[model samples]
Target: MTRSVYVTSIERGDGRQIVELGVMELLTRRVDRVGVFRPLVHDGPDRLFDLLRSRYRLTQDPATGYGMSYDEASTVQAEEGTDELVSRLVDRFHALARDYEAVLVLGTDYAGSQLPEELALNARLANEFGAAVLPVVGGRGQSAESVHTEARNAHRAYAQLGCEIPALFVNRVTPADREEVRDQLAAHLPVPCYVLPDEPALAAPTVAQIAQALQGTVLLGDDAGLARDALDFVFGGAMLPNLLKALTPGCVVITPGDRADLVVGALAAHSAGNPPIAGVLLTLGERPGKEILALADRLAPGTPVISVAGTSFPTATQLFTLEGRLSAATPRKVETALGLFEQCTATGELLDQISAPRSTRITPMMFQHQLLERARADRRHVVLPEGTEERVLHAAEVLLRRGVCDLSLLGPVDSIRKKAADLGIDLGRARLVDPTTSELRDDFAARYAELRAHKGVTLDLAHDVVADANYFGTLMVEQGLADGMVSGSVHSTAATIRPAFEIIKTATPKAGPGTAAGGEPAAAPIVSSVFFMCLADRVLVYGDCAVNPDPGARQLADIALQSAATAERFGVEPRIALLSYSTGTSGAGADVDKVREATELARARRPDLPIEGPIQYDAAVDPVVAATKLPGSAVAGRATVLIFPDLNTGNNTYKAVQRSAGAFAVGPVLQGLRKPVNDLSRGALVGDIVHTVAITAIQAQEPG
Candidate 1:
């Protein structure tokens, strides 16, 4: 039987989308094939469902997500009966549930719903689908006592209907009334209750939404600016100076387009980020002339300037009623909603109550989720040297918003801030440092000079080198100011990791009997790298792909050990396979001999670990091939960590798998370093940067 959770609300304005998104996040974290079903939806596009689909990379057909439209449901229930309506819905749900391990059943929204007994209808559908009911109650304008009674009644109502109630959520409660509501509900309800305080940002409308609602023309704004939440609306009826004083950080200034002075003044204030108004709304269908419009564009490059035909009074009333939605276009709001949900809800307890079974296969999405969860578990500070880069900044916003880790972005602080502001991103609590002018520059330069004195490096020369962002960022890791560093989005691998080698150096093994000929312990091999090849069914670790051009037998063994450790650390069970052109002594050559020797050496080092080598790629991965070529080998056909004989083979193989097989390769994650320092592809996307940063944070949590 497939496990499912039915997310419903008692009334309109319950803000149940937050609960829905949060539950979806939880489901995707545990299962690979998670389905989404909406029992009854409006005729138009479903914004919340679209958000879930895009964010989670869901593959469920959009047509299958809905049982029927609200209009259709109303007609069915009215003409035939409630039983006929539910029977059709249950059949539609089971059709979707059959293909998924778990399904998230989205219940009917009570807003404008014409079906009689909406609450009872949702309860009946949840019971029929065998899904645990998670009810949300609105508390935005209710008293604490009223909210308590409502939440209690919600739980009782579902329980009385024979629906298994997992928990109750009281959303959009005032901050002052959250604790009071929780206390009162805790004494009454059997299930756990979570209270989410009201977030004005979630309720605020974006300038684009307002423009669309009013059918206005967008005179000036980019997509990012249009997505800015209009947290407040200020009517611009006064002079420019007084209008500037009324501006708020995310408010939209409404005035007649003929008021050129107010338009330019408000935009100028926004450009200076004095309050950073969300946009300027021009009414009465009167746009400014070319000169004034040009001046406004120069003042605020991406600030929205919308022109509507309505007067200020009617437009203000319309704006007040327009609320922001959680949609694919509003990524910032999605992050905010998830952040708010994670803060208020005990995710672990709720998930336990829901008890969705974990998927046996580790999908790419699940691996990425595990990376974030592990990184967030023990927060570490990871530095990004390319702070001014747009992808890095975007990834920084996501990391900070998700509470993944503390970050220190190395660049000119003002440039980063201006760029972020232009892109409509908020780098909350992220530490920004300029390598050239930071107070620690002198200290870093002196230290670099001392460390490289034997190389004839002078203080001035060292000063210039230390002023580079990668060097400064690496030095911060060396000096314990940061836990790790992730660079190379724009820089070459050498430019990024060269600083790490020069300053942080490699780790040395503990003094033991197997010492070097000079009676000193040997340092570990120069840092190796691994690319987590996330195939459709599982994540495989490919080592030495981005480093180590060629290695002797001993270095090959070292890479194998390091790769296996990296795999196990990230939750992949390590079954080592030393790849060669041959399988298990079937062929002999310098290359195959090296792999065979390395396999023996690695097995000698750790006898308990599953190890196979001198194996053909086909034999190593395909069970049928393994049975024919090398039967009954533990690592054959099920290898999770693959060590190539040299970089030439490893790099080409990972690329082939990534491109030919359409795999999502996550690394080139540098291993064997004293601390974590990962590299990124020059063509990396925003999501790729986020995954790399999270991986770096997790690596930093490990002991040297």
Candidate 2:
């Protein structure tokens, strides 16, 4: 009878940090149970709020094994004639509300003419304690008329206790008034509206932290690596080319260049050899432009650069008035201050279920991602490109009109029915191609003479590049007709890796001179190609950006078994690290003996790999420098899958850690192809080509 949900938060200083970050982020989006009960003592004492609630243990409710009953009365001293302190807080929280199933009662700073008289004494204690009255408003200049008087006092005291559901928390807001308080309480709140997100994570900003937070000067404009720990909030005052046309790159924040032509045109369009600019904050003294320090020394040579000198709105108002003593942030600025540590360091289950907002999930609609919900539940297909076949035919007619996917499109059936009747699109029973017919020009001249049969094709040059309607778009993905294929707009990732290495290669084959994260692997069998890199729940896979340039250490043990079989085909357990410049048995070149021979030949070809390496990228991602230097190396300190050793150190260390590693580099995500094929970077970013066509439509049924 207790699936668990006992939450009792109504705040002032500690409504247990936004009820332990919205009941462990709504029990990681709907129930596996969640806990956290008492910790309220504000009129300045309950032994100093039970000594800061026993410094963070919060009495108890660690899901099911319940906790919290710190009484010490005066919740704003009887807010509206307190029925004996609201019947002793519903008799000590209804004796732990008859051992839980759902108890979310929140409302601490409860008053201001007693919020409809303390929501009618928290609705006779959620109806004499069965429990479910959510209201937690906790202030800081709230107003939408104090969130429409706490949603008309939790809808007239839960419709005089008949019951309704809608918990509201605006909590100290001001990231430009959170979508106007979610556009005036999203059609006036019924329940579920948590808004936390302005954390800056401090520590590395001195002059006694920029004279106690204001007026800048930490100059060292990193190509974009600028002291690599990424999350860019660069808001240089109005029309600095409207803050470089409000930048759109992973975790970008670069506006305070004091408008030296929009800070040297957003440091020559984002730095690091030119593409890196995650940190180069020159507000009023706007420095760094000897071509952004020679493109940050040809991108990331001595990266970490900071320089602040005020005037970018009093240095973003002394960084939101020292955003609560700056929680030491720097791992590319953890989402630049995850809204003040989502009420102080994400708690319990992982709180996220306010039903899809701004849409970005990648996984968890109850543990999904088996190649994206099994190529969207077995109905696969999705292609689109004839001028983005009307934006993948309106995302494949809304994923086959909501049954969710089985549509394709290449071109010329009368320019895709006059561009889907001039974009009023309807391809209802979809599936079309015409690459100027004749059985699609003999399947685009046998996939362009099987990718230029070693560069000498001529049946009139494979009928002039398979009749150039863009080589029937890589011959609708080498004639499977299309389970997956989302080409780089006008083509060139060497025209999408020469027809997937002459029509789909790698079923698992590679040897001698293969693994090229930088280069020198493969005495044989280390075939390379990677990109998995999800982002939402944090995935990571990376290897030879999209195919080798210099691979060795037994072709980096077949590019760490194709990046740990595409991070266990996306459920992710692959820890592999390999990146070098030394960690274990410290430095000694031949490029740290080719990342300690590709970490003992990828732990002797995947001997249950959680592989490590010559290491150091801060000891493979800093878990306190992998517990002070490789303590029991389970892949150094929790590496998700880094593996570079060549391809100019994996395409300039993933475009200089995708403009200085703050976070959000979804991919060059190609992986060892047989089915999914991707490559778009000439002007990539129609949201990285709609997440590279949703990672080539979740590799339409992967078996190839």
Candidate 3:
């Protein structure tokens, strides 16, 4: 079983970064902890390592991730010999490998290094680390014959070194020659060879690079604008009309500081969306007047305007010399690179060839990934009531980008668009509905009044009440116009769920031993909720956290059953613990008695479930305590679903874990409702909203 992969290049500039990213993304999807190691690193921060660290939330210390710097390696090799250097690096590599399920070993770069025989060194390290090597060859300036030769030679070099070469890649091939090269290499090579076409966007320098290289001051811009790639540079020595003609899409315009006329003209063109430029560079430390600056602000709200002291000649030289590198600071480019790699390569075949070990533990990130993937598999429509809120809009943008579900945002349509524009969020493909004046308003009101007629809800009163966003969204779900609804980002939990209770109500009673015979049928399951408490290594389900305040034994048992079913629905095995202040008759109290009764009732109701009674929090989660207090109990310590005695304990425990232990509480995901309607906390971030919406989509998939 291979535990690591080595991504090396035949030489520098092979564009192996794309392959590295694709591998990391693949590993993360299958495993929780993916470690990164570079056998040799240059002094200072490694851009590629930093990208992997931040993007994947790697916990490995940077000092331990590398063996030695180029200078240190060279010095050690000269003083101690090559064998000693290899041995030392091997020790460092294993140190990181032991901590993770799998490690990705980035091979030494051929650029800016004092180390000798780099290819031999990489192969030796891969051999010692017991790694599979995937070598990359650059084809930017090569023909089909040259590319084929290099690919074969690179594979042979690694194979001769006794390193496992499962597959190979030929990167940066010209678009026209991509297919021919792929065919030729596929025929001759003994292993799979992936050919990637040249991507100009990945090679373009961003505005942030211009600011750093020229040592300029940022006159106006945000982080988003700074990350935009400056594809081409246009010097502003020409007249306004000539400059307008010269402006190309995503180009940076350089002009004298006093060229306010040129500045306004360029910004106006960008505002009109006519070949929008990346940014404007003001030379000679010049700035526009207050009025012109204000106009510039309105014309291009987020475009970068940098002021540099150098003349245009020196600036242009620096800009032309700049080359793009992958980093955490530029996330858009990372997405583009990953998308390109996935599209051009046979990822499934490559992964099978490498055969990375499957991980058992599910990290918080892994849980979130599963949620989104599940939601997208069979997408359902989800409506958001707080569409005008900034966080809601942001989550909607992410949901659309991930293709999680169909979204219908309920609010004033014009206001929602304006809010999204102000936040620079693209609500692409998300439908906007103004509840007050929608074409379905009268139809929805009629339906609502009919549903509540026995409760004295007249048509006039139902019409006015249905205008509220929460009620309107609930109506959409009830009418099957939308599959589910998520709200309460700004509204209270009661305000968000009250409409659901009135319209959707509890699901029609499930059949089984619990059902009645002739007319009325069985009692409906208790309407409860659960918060998916995502810890560092696993996810635990906490029941009745936000909905029920206090319940008797039967209600508590129903909550447990609902929680266990919910747990199984979301991929968690349901070993249930009825939490209390006492464990196994060690203490006596009303709380303990309630938990004890609840556990017995739950077991009677569902004999298939694993249940424990009156278990303390520590005993429920800690194996050592479980062994001491409740010996031989199935769910004493390994419980994944914990049913609290009351809301006070469940809510407080979840909040403490979320704030102190840094767990991500993805719910109060309301269960037992006829239709799926989940509530968000008033302080939920964009990520929390995204996860909740995904969970709701999954819930909507269950048979009602």
Cα lDDT for residue 276, model 1? 78
Best by lDDT: 1
TM-score for candidate 1 = 0.94
In model 2, the worst 10-residue window by lDDT is 349-358
Off by over 4 Å in 1: 510-525
- TM-score versus the correct structure, for each prediction: 0.94, 0.30, 0.83
User: lDDT score of model 2?
Assistant: 0.51
Candidate 1 displacement at residue 43 in angstroms: 1.4
Q: Which wins on TM-score, candidate 2 or candidate 3?
A: 3
Q: How far out, in Å, is residue 288 in model 3? A: 1.2
Position 291, candidate 3: lDDT: 92
Tens digits of lDDT, candidate 2, 1-704: 32223233343432234343334334333332223333233332233123222422233443322122223344334443555555655566555545533334433444242334444554555555544444444445565466545545545556665643435555545456666665676566655565553332222232223332443454442222332323335565576557666664322344555344655555444532223334445555557667765654443343334456656576666554442222222222222232243433222212322221222333322222233234444565656544444344444443443333455666666556544433333464777766556476865676677677787896667866765544555566667776666665556676765656565654554432225454433323333566655443455767877567878777776676677766676666778887877788867878779778767766654456577887877788668889988898887767878888887877777677666754445557666666676776665544455455655676555655
Report the backbone clash tally of model 1: 0
Q: What are the lDDT figures for the candidates, one per model? A: 0.88, 0.51, 0.86
Deviation (Å) of 50 in candidate 3: 2.6
User: What would the per-residue lDDT of candidate 1 be over residues 14-96, giving only the tens digit for each residue?
Assistant: 98999999999989989998999999888778998898899998878999998998999989999999999999999999999
* Candidates in order: C-alpha RMSD to true structure: 2.8, 24.2, 4.5
